[model samples]
Target chain A: MSDTPENVAATNAEARNERHRERMVRKKTVMDERIANAQSERGLLLVNTGIGKGKSSSAFGMVARALGHGLKVGVVQFIKGRVSTGEQLFFKRFPEEVRYHVMGEGFTWETQDRQRDIETAGKAWEVAVELLNDPGIALVVLDELNIAFKHGYLDVDQILEDLRNRPLTQHVVVTGRGAPQALIEAADTVSDMSLVKHAFQSGIRAQKGIEF
Target chain B: MSDTPENVAATNAEARNERHRERMVRKKTVMDERIANAQSERGLLLVNTGIGKGKSSSAFGMVARALGHGLKVGVVQFIKGRVSTGEQLFFKRFPEEVRYHVMGEGFTWETQDRQRDIETAGKAWEVAVELLNDPGIALVVLDELNIAFKHGYLDVDQILEDLRNRPLTQHVVVTGRGAPQALIEAADTVSDMSLVKHAFQSGIRAQKGIEF
Candidate 1:
């Protein structure tokens, strides 16, 4: 109420706060409507793909969340079996809750045998199909399955068909780079994890319990 | 060797495999050298930010990894205290292993009080600082702290200063949208999660286990 500079500033701040509050009220109404309209619930096909980190990590995070809710999770890692990762070591502890299978011999370059790679991928897919068909498995993470599709090791059409026909209440998270267009189209949620910067590029070694 | 169609295909495949093997051998040498050169090991400042999902989920994944390695973990959630997410519910089960703190009244819009929001963020920062200072806590997750900085509730410079002075082997992961430029520069690794498509956009509600 005073003419002083401090009082004027306070008054202006109050007005701004009032405006923000009103805007938020309008936003809340719209959000409420959207939430109300979204009554449908079922399985989701989540794709975490791109050239960035965290795609698999995010999927693993969901694995943790799923386990928290006492859900059974099945993880079929398709192309990273050379060295054991931290996620593998950690999730394997919950043997009853998580069915984790590290199905790759190693990276494609390391494998270098096309016939063997296809065989390995086929084996992994068999395990994945089993998980997908099981109603008890709440969340199935097909880690790096896209890379198999990208390298023509697995049939994309077949993978899509299997994903489409999975249990009604089961959730699937597919992670890796170059997720096929068809898979993206079939996905319910798709996150493109983009690399902004990497510690490895900055001369930092990938350490245990972090990168792995 | 036979000159039949099957024989010809086998020969071509063998030649291709040989060529690929040679390429991989060369690549391995370069990779081995890079691995040998990266000898430095210490604490890392990691930032996961952008307008997409999984920023927090990936951080949670790292927390799982850290815990898997028998490392102590700490989590401080900012601007997400209104609703108890699955991560919070799940992580809270491990009281001895995890020092989890949910320190926010709600989102900024819901709170509608700048003073209160700032105070809550300051309190969260206090908890974060404690985690950062503890050398025993191997990994500390500052979930949605970037949003607090984005809304001007906390000082970026001060946050960076604390991060820089943390324990020698401590690893920190900050997750949320609009990570400050300073924080990104300070980070060892930064991932920008971009939304390709979201289920909520397709008339699906945020589910209990997946979204939370």
Candidate 2:
């Protein structure tokens, strides 16, 4: 019993098979249903920090997910003019359920006019605030609002306070580098995007539909 | 109430004030209780599609979030073999809860040996499968795996079958450009990044930390 070659091979195979089965179980455990169950009774997420990469992309994923579940979504892009985005284009597929508004003065330098940049931000903030209060709006992504705060175009205190009091049924997502510490502190969940690697580093230019 | 100039001015001012207050209320509604509740739940996500931007960066955001919550995480990067990423560098700060592995045969064409590429992929996948099965491992990120599938070095059906059966407490994330339709369909969530505009198109290379 201890020296049979066939028995040893069979034993080794069984061990390997068990390990394989275990891995499969672990992967399935990570599904959305499990995540939904693990979620807190309240949902308040703040995605902030230095502009590394993919902050807005992650928020967009959530928007799509919520929208798929038949929830309404609203998005306001600060300092980003009316330029089209892939997400905006995709969301257009469900125009009846998604609303997007870009309050952009383009880039700060592009605007050149400080007063105009401020005016544009002010108008966008107005729209953002309106969407924030609408309980029917399940998710709202504030793209690039951090730059507005970092540049003093928007008030951090106001942003945090408003977010703190936003509709209990709505989910707010803010994307930008250099998020205020106060906002981070007030957020129920904070995700800091730290870049690991990117192709652009290799002298490859950002390709359309892949980088926009 | 005389129809005096002062009375008219007072009424106009009140209306303007109400509008402003309404805007504030609207904005504040974005941080609702539902979003907070959702965060407590653990989940798995896969960000994949053709050569685009931010798939890994987006997944890293969740890795950071999960780490902040004291969850164990493991990362396996495929195709990106040569350089060190900021994510790996930062993860060094928390050696106990995080592990990083790079499974690459360098550039595809550089690997003139087809059998060698397949062998390298198989070796790395062995480790990835191990991580996927570990229940104590709360979050697992398979970075740039789509390239393996695209290159036909990895078996998609086998990997999907394993992922589908993984542990219930584990959350798995796969990030790569050009994710197959079958994988997307199998996933609880899928995001196709459409590039619209990118800074690289202007001849600027990737910036450190911002890109890699």
Candidate 3:
């Protein structure tokens, strides 16, 4: 039997597909069992913090994900209110579902006055607490709250207590650098972004839309 | 001088605005110098890996950011090709600029046959290399490539060599868990997601548009 190149390739592909099918069947069995075993469901407490970039970016991405599910989201910015970012503009399109309040006294260096920073952070936390209590909002993003906590502007213990008492089905996300140890322990999920190589280090100024 | 709530609030807001403006002016002075000093610009090699969620989600979010800037983007999925994710469906809308390719034989456990899994991964890497080399593509996302590397299906060194030779402005993102040491070292940016809690552990099934 003479086999042309196309025929030989076709035969090989068919064999591979068959093997792949068998393997997936076995895997599905295992996964099904595991899926069945996991039984509890509750709102998530996700924390994103570190020296690396994308902390706030990831949280914003989740806002998109939550919105894709038709879920209402509430966002409170602490140290980044001064910047009008692309995300803010995009999420603004969904005014009914997204409650985005940019509240901050800028970065610590810019603010200079620690007392004013604390008061502003306190105000932002008040908004966050309101969002957390409202069951209508499915997810609440506490952007840069870690910075406020790190600078001793916001009380971590008080924030943790409030988060613990939030609506049962309302998910919450905290993003910024230097998440406190207490907060980390209280959190259900934490992602510490590691700065590997930054474009800023190479003299590329933060590009619009990319960094902001 | 009776300070009703409205008068007090207005005064406070005006004072805050003045301070904010002054602070921003100083910040701009410093920032302008930094921006002027920064001189290098090149395509970044970013890696998002960890046990937490949002790795691929973050990478895809970058795809959106790049698109917002009118840049051409390419995406190659290694182990998640079977699922029709929200990102896949959304990005598909931009067919002209986005070269989205879902190439995989499913996860390692599902494939069962190591040889077949390896072959699938190799094919995917070939596609990744193609995207990496194509100057027309400004951003290339090798989604779940770390999973292939974690499974020992693809050679890290070979991938690194290709990335090193990519176009100067061609950004690449490698996403999935347990990114090999060499890949992390070579990457310009790395975010190690820290998983504190997972919805799946609580028996909350992955919903459409959120988990897919």
Candidate 4:
């Protein structure tokens, strides 16, 4: 006996539902175990890295999250001082909760002076170190520091040492491409964004709010 | 000739400076041409997908960017209607510019019915379709719609057709894991977030404000 069209559709829907139930049951078991075992809580070291464009964007979003929680936040920028970003402009509205610092001279091409870039990176790192040590600051963002770290303007070892001794209650988010292995090892969470496609590659100029 | 520690440090810094200058000069030429040729401007279909986290967070960051520019924005949340997210709470500050819609029955585990899930997804798509056709809305974020697309609850072809017919000046950002190949191909920009390390993998529970 052949099944009717209505019956076939119902059967297909039932089969899909059963498959979803089984998969989620297995996931629940794993997640429950993980959640049960999590007893210790402390501030996290999060690194957003890779060739994708959303690394810095995600880090800044976390800044918004931190601020929403009534947490004090500090932001330090390195190697990207030419353009004031939308995130910076928006966060400036809340001066009481956010300490914003744009400490880079500019891009290497724009500045063309390695000595100046190094000095600027040094100043930004100084700010980062201070932010990391401040227990009152709940979240600190080291935006684009990975670019300077990649270019050797900043010492990875020194930064790692500072991160190790950061305040127990202060969260830190580091963003940029080519994050060093040491920082990755030291971080509690790491997200590496992979570029499937970028608007810039398609001859789209960096717009004011989107790119900045 | 043997040199003092300070002299060796000074000489090394100078050599490093010289290398950076040469490398940057070459990089500048390439970047200049790339920047010069990038002249196109249009609204984009951006998809953030993969198993890694931060897909929705980045999408919301774009919403903030859109809002910062005083653009009208619409956000539709799918499959995450159970918990209130930080982005939703914060975006509610700008009620005039944002039209927020949470139209899901929670995760599949909680819903457990394929027919119900399909109906919920359809309703969310209806809201998204309305937003897409509205030229006054500068950006529309379809959060977690990929899950519906991944599960066959929604027709990918229908979505592709709708995306093709969307308002010319309106940007759409779709966020979730396991985006279909067709959507990826149709999208102007795509970012695939890869997990290096996740807090959940280390038996860490999702904390309030950070995870939500």
Candidate 5:
């Protein structure tokens, strides 16, 4: 007797399920091995760079993550001193946990004063150095520090040296566009955020709390 | 002598400064006009997707920004219910500000059961719909929802319809890898994070408080 349509459908479904299970079983084996091999844990040097929107936003998110773990965090805004961003205002609520500093006069084009910018960057580096040296600070965010290096306002070698010399267990997140090759080479984890689309391009204004 | 070395150096610096100032002045005029044109305000659909890190981290960062603005935020984490990430633990502190939900039975590969996965995704979508319907929730983070759609566990059309029907002033952030083309077109701001390097590839385990 010929099998019914319902029985044939059920048989097909079973075959598909079996195939899926076998594929997953193989994938699981590979993943388990990878997870098992990753045994070392220490502080990491993370870089967020490229012409993207979330470079600073992601760094601030890490700040939230660090704070959530009951860890002390430090933030040094290298080229965003002109405006008080949403992250700045929100992080202020956690004064006991976050050490926040805004150190730039403005963007390079806005400032148009190389000597003054160099001075400001110098001062910001000093604050960063202090944070890097502090063992108590588990995570340090150098927001837009890459801009300073890109503009020749700061020395990349010196910055890399400071990053290298930071507390062994203290993680640092450096963010901005045009991260120098040397910095990327030194970083443990680097994410290049590429802008696929932006609201501003579509005539949507930068909204409060969303884009500060 | 025609001029001393000091005098020539000073003259060159002055000329460079003048040129920079002129360039900036022209750029500022264009920027000012653009800023003036962007006077309208509304909620945005922000998408963070790619084969890289920090997609969800950036979403959580926005969560901090939203909370800083005293806005109510909802986070519906799909496909990441097995491990308790740091964001989950940290955001838990803000019970009054954030409504958090972890609604997956782990990843699809780990689950290895299409029928059960579809049911779990359905339940998660129900929760998301409720949040989207609420006007009080300023920001809704549908973390890893793209994966559900990619794996055919959920319908992309239905998801888009719900997103479109959300409160006019409520912003939504969708994050995951391999975001659908439809979602990208619908999004106001989309960031494609490209992984340059990862610590895990170097045998460094995902650390607590950082990777989680």
Candidate 6:
């Protein structure tokens, strides 16, 4: 009786499968119990105040998540318009569910036009307001809009008033450093991402895939 | 003229808003661009290998993202049986989009019935596989499924084969420790969450609303 390695391996695999089957036979299980679900009602969310990593990343991740379910998601990015980044690049993959709009001036320094910056911010705000009213649109991520309010390009009062008045089913996410008192107070969930430490502070240039 | 503190505070608030508006007008602002959307073609995936943290949390985060877009998602947790969890608790918020299947056996040591464990895992897998194929089901997260394979309660190859053949548009995520090499190899993108450092090792019990 010759015993081959292949035969032995096969025998072992069968035994493993048998063991697995045995375990399943004795365990009791429950099917269909979910704890966390997406917010159905309209609410305001402020991803605010602090120099921390993953604020934009987290927001974009949410955007991607929303788009995955065939939801109309509108994103308006502020204080970021240099070269293309990961989020922007990936946004092209799903143009139907996601609409991407940028202020287009790049950072506040590169434009060097104060009047133009305010005009651009105001225009973006108009679009965001319009999106807020569209019930078909499930999420409106105002990326870095806090910086706009902090800089005073757009009226904080108007922004807050509009957000409050927007359709109740529309969920809004405002992200940026130094979110104002008004925005924070009006928001249902306020997440302050305090930066304990960062790689950029240590002189590590942002990597392509990880940072961008 | 009676000068009151309330009057002074109101005046200060208006001045603060004015100052912010002026500063924003001067800043040259740009918006972050969304390059493209998420890779929806990438089917659902779960990474369960070794006890670091961020496994189930990350998975559930994606689930929330999906649900926010009005997409249906299902979750099945093994080894987390007979007990309530933060994820389970949160699922109540969205009773429609999120469906859960929990094994009542809890952990293997607690049950000590290998046959029953395997049977329960098989039953859960049956439901999970059903969801994986459902085109309307955008994302399916099998939380802590690695334990099922590790303890000989589930068949890794069979699961991988099923996933490989599932609906192309549907996304799935699995989270747990000790994920099998076969599953890793089969994944379109495999993120191995190595434990370089963890808060739990430093004498911090899992806190509610954070770790749980």
Tell me the TM-score of model 6. 0.47
lDDT string for model 6 (A67-138, tens) is 544457888887665566656665645677777787546666555555677888888888787787778777
lDDT string for model 5 (B49-113, tens) is 98877898888888888887788999999978456877888899888889999999897779888
Docking class of 1: medium
TM-score of chain A of each: 0.96, 0.84, 0.88, 0.90, 0.94, 0.77
For residue A29, what is the lDDT in candidate 3? 94
List the candidate numbers ranked by DockQ, top first: 1, 5, 4, 3, 6, 2
Docking verdict class for candidate 2: incorrect
Candidate 3: residue A113 lDDT (0-100): 72
Task: Put down candidate 1 lDDT per residue, B1-212, tens digits, no spaces.
Answer: 98999999999989987887787678778877887888788888889998888898899889888888788999999967456787887888899999999998887767777778889999999999999999999999999999899878899999899998999999999999999999998899999999999899888888766888
Q: Give the residue spans of candidate 5 off by over 4 A.
A: none
TM for candidate 5 is 0.96
User: Considering just chain B, what TM-score does every model have?
Assistant: 0.96, 0.81, 0.86, 0.93, 0.94, 0.75
Worst 10 residues of 3 chain A by lDDT: A203-212
Candidate 1, residues A16-73: lDDT per residue as tens digits?
A: 7787778767777887798898888999999999998899889988988887777899
TM-score, one value per model:
0.96, 0.51, 0.76, 0.92, 0.96, 0.47
Clashes of each: 1, 49, 11, 0, 0, 54
Error of 6 at A19 (Å): 28
Q: Which ten residues in a row have the lowest lDDT in candidate 1 chain B?
A: B79-88
Put down candidate 4 lDDT per residue, B41-75, tens digits, no spaces.
88888899988767887877677666666678899
CA shift of B14, model 5, Å: 3.0
To one decimal place, how large is model 5's interface RMSD in Å? 1.6
Better candidate by TM-score, 1 or 6? 1
Q: Mind giving the per-residue lDDT tens digits that candidate 5 earns over A120-178?
A: 99999999999999999999999999999987889999889888898898999999999
